[model samples]
Target: MKNQTSITSVLLMSLSDDQETISVLFIFFLLIYLMTVFSNFLIILLVVTCAHLHTPMYFFLGNLAFLDMSCSSVTAPSMLSHLITQHWSMSLSECIIQMFFVIYFAGSEAFLLSSMSYDRYVAICRPLHYSQLMSWGTCAEMASLVWSTPFLLTITYTICLRRLTFCGPNLIQNFFCDLPHLFQISCTDPTINVFILIIVGGTVGIAAFVITFYPYVRIFRAVLRIGTSDGKSKAFSTCTSHLTVVTIFYVSATFIYLVPDTSNLLTLNCVFSVIYTLITPLLNPLIYSLRSKDLKAALSKALHIHRLHPDTATRR
Candidate 1:
């Protein structure tokens, strides 16, 4: 790549520089990426085709599946390609665009998780009013808010980052063009960028965390109030999958962002980045669909329908 800007391009660090390790890691990540796409797509297919899953819960879940695929796409494919060639290079513009989407989808996922939590809270805590509370319009509005706000905010920071000139070593010590990694290579002061990340991005993270978990606090209380063991069991079952997902996502996110890394090192950040960017997306659909009898039934039904008429999809 030719130098197009103050710095023409940046070199991204591979997960491993060793050829043998790169080969092994390439295969491992390829399998993981493929599995993540397939699993999330399965959830989407089941949600779209199954009439029984058209409720608010599954609607949010379908959106999540789409986001998971997108988030994984942002980094996994690029990382895989770089691993194979052992050459991780991207032009300045490409790096900025990649970072934008990474943050965009990540922030959107955070808000979407919170939205799903609210849906669960309504369904379990106020069962009588779930329909009234989570009507089609309400859900649509929430979805729109979660998706759009993140894009705008991410754009703001990306543009801020773009304005910063890069005149130093163009090597980024991470698999992808993460904001922090980008900050490390900038010639201009990144104090404002850091401020936005901490104040704006941190605020978003905290808000997402509070929204996502606060509902569970009430949910737990309501679950305990149930008199029958079966009722309590049923209530807990409804939210456990979501709770598991939330815990994984938030813990990874908090470790990455909220708690400052005193060392400002890239090694630890890379590990956590892989968790949320790749592992969380890979696990989200499983968490939602694994223990779900309805999802299983839907999947079975879809397969059965496909077996009955292989050409049905083509006709549609």
Candidate 2:
């Protein structure tokens, strides 16, 4: 294939080609996007407004809610627009920007999940030192690290991606601009890019996974030693929601990133991408609200207060 320096855009593949099917999908995804944003926003709002929820756990949860909303927003609007207009082409710059945020938010979320797990471990395994270990200052530092570290890594990844030549076919096989898809289509050899992805990305992912789940081992041991059934139940309840969210996020992400990208697996990759990008955000709020009694109680109290003092709520 001859190199074309003027290749400035790429075509994104839509899930369906039929206009009728596209319309149905557009409506379905639009609803999911709206619900995802609203629900996650509500979680953030609840965490911010509820004084009783101003603990380390809720602090990390609020950050997760924000990340979920931001992460979903990175792709949902673009995908919805493509579905509605049946326009699957995006400028190279736009695609690169989207890819940058995708990596940034995803990496940040993995680290944030690890932070949350540490918070739980402290609460369960080191209850006597929970306050000191998970101080507001310490939590702030961890949150800063989670958000900032990924920006650097994503910048490095994007710089490497920018150096690659995309002079050949510019049709991306999936709905969004992901690294693997981009690497696959590069006219130039992507051996360096692949190495960075595997070395840097893999190290971060593995470390985050270890940080996020390894605590559960100690947590389980601690819970087992609790004398009362109620004690064990309460301890497990605190972890169940975070664990569920972590499992879903890591499982989907691992499948998409770790598995070899072959022609036969492109469709499967897209499906898993949808799960991580769209479905996970929608499920996060549901999982937290349904499994977390504190969040439910906080929502109830907020609603009751709103009903009683509509004027006050409006003014605020």
Candidate 3:
């Protein structure tokens, strides 16, 4: 086994080795990366500029959009570059940094989703207290906690990873440097890392999952209690988008992380990783914007304003 000094880089596996397949994948994923960035950015812009959207929910959404963009960025560029150039090797430090951000944003997004669910619960179940419960200050505090806590956890995980030596067979099975893939390549005993992953990571995931979905139980109950169909429809509409996103995120993520990464499952893991990392970000803005009348109106208004005054829009 080689020491840390000897292993300076690790090779990321490509989705395909065939030149034609690589080209097709490059084009497909490049488009996905671009759309994910642009759409998420649009959500942030709308939330920032549209006064109507300056509520606690949109505030959390803007943060989610930012996180989605960031999480997609953490891997998509590197994966896309590898697809195009077939140069799959990255410096070990770069890989670690990428892994850190990947875990950071992912964990952060999970908690943020829980926050969004809580926001929805307050709005629907306790409408009278929504203002008090989800004030700007409260939202800011939640956002701060969402970002900071995961950061510290990721730092601990990364520190543990750095202590491990990488000797031979440095090829990562996935398109990016993920925790499980990284553990598989370590020359040193990764028992501690695995322990932290299983205990801390599992606890965090379960906590976030409970926080995120438990509200929906009450929310559904409240929705069911509504007298009129229109009233029920309106309340359900508000939550459906968020619920869809949360479901997709957790389901895809669970498949990627929980499933055994055996030889037969490697390809399936790659597919799920694509769903979790690439497709989810791409779908978020579309899901929220399409389902939301307020967002649609705001987008339309923004577009009309842009068309009416392209110069002003460009200056801004």
Candidate 4:
């Protein structure tokens, strides 16, 4: 029988047991991590340096890109290291730390996207007040709220979660040590923890989604009523990028939460996690640039900055 005392929450901080799988997966994840980082960094750079992207919409997109970059960075690199090394242990402290950032970044991204959607709605529906209403102060306050609120709540949840004793098997069935996965492996009943997760999570995380989307329902009605064909087209196009991101994140997240945690579904869980965490960041830059002509222009200017001093740029 396995020794009850000899167990840990993190299985693979360094090369895990699955050597062949780890080798292949490590390369794949490394490529994705670099892409996510580069793409998000470029998006943020374009938003900040380019005059055309100084609007509130791109402002929010910039933050989303930042959050996505952070979310992927917090988990993916360490995870890749675990897949390739002999040491596969994340102490309780480390695990909780990872969990905190992951949840915070994830939560912040969600809230920001919802806020962005509301910004789009205001711009398209209430053009007169769009600028005045979504001024620098308002934007900063919203951004602060998004960041600080999620950070505090997730820290509390993670603290409570880490206190649970791990007398059972330590082998985490999935790639990363998620809340549900950890609770599932515990020796005692995780009723209270799971209950808290659903209540706190469903209320805060899911509530943000509801608040964001419900307004869109009304905004779409207004979009349809626009007198000019061009007006309708523009309004719909403005929402396209936000909708794509929201759909991608919410769908994958729902699946991860809705599907009863089961060994049979472990593979599916990992795949869906990749969809939201790894894949979403790459899509954000491409989607924004392609869908919005303004972002494309900003990107052009950003690229042009180097062209202006191509010789000097190369020297440095």
Q: Write down the lDDT of every candidate, Cα atoms only.
A: 0.88, 0.91, 0.91, 0.79
- Per-residue CA lDDT of model 2 for 199-227, tens digit only, reads 99889889999999999999999999999
What's the candidate order when arranged by decreasing lDDT? 2, 3, 1, 4
Location of the lowest summed lDDT over 10 successive residues in candidate 2:
1-10
The TM-score that candidate 3 achieves is 0.96
In the range 105-213, model 3's lDDT, one tens digit per residue, is: 9999999999999999999999999899888899989999899999999988988876787774788888898778778887889998899988998898899999999
Q: Local error of candidate 2 at 106, Å?
A: 0.4
Candidate 4: worst-modelled 10 consecutive residues by lDDT: 6-15
At residue 209, give the lDDT of candidate 2.
93
Tens-digit lDDT track of model 4 for 33-79:
99889988988988887877888888898899889898888878777
Model 4 ranges off by over 4 Å: 1-6, 12-22, 86-88, 314-316
Model 2: number of backbone collisions: 0
Candidate 3, residue 238: the lDDT equals 95
- Residue 184 alpha-carbon offset, candidate 1, angstroms: 1.3
TM-score of each: 0.93, 0.96, 0.96, 0.91
Q: What is the Cα root-mean-square deviation between model 3 and the actual structure? A: 1.6
**Greater-lDDT candidate between 2 and 4:** 2
Tens digits of lDDT, candidate 1, 1-316: 1353578799987677688888888888899999999999989988897899999999999999999999999999998888877788989889888989988998898899999999999999998999999999999999999999998899889778766888658988777887887888887889998988889988877888899999999999999999999999999999889889988987887777655645575578788889989999999988877868899899888888878998986698
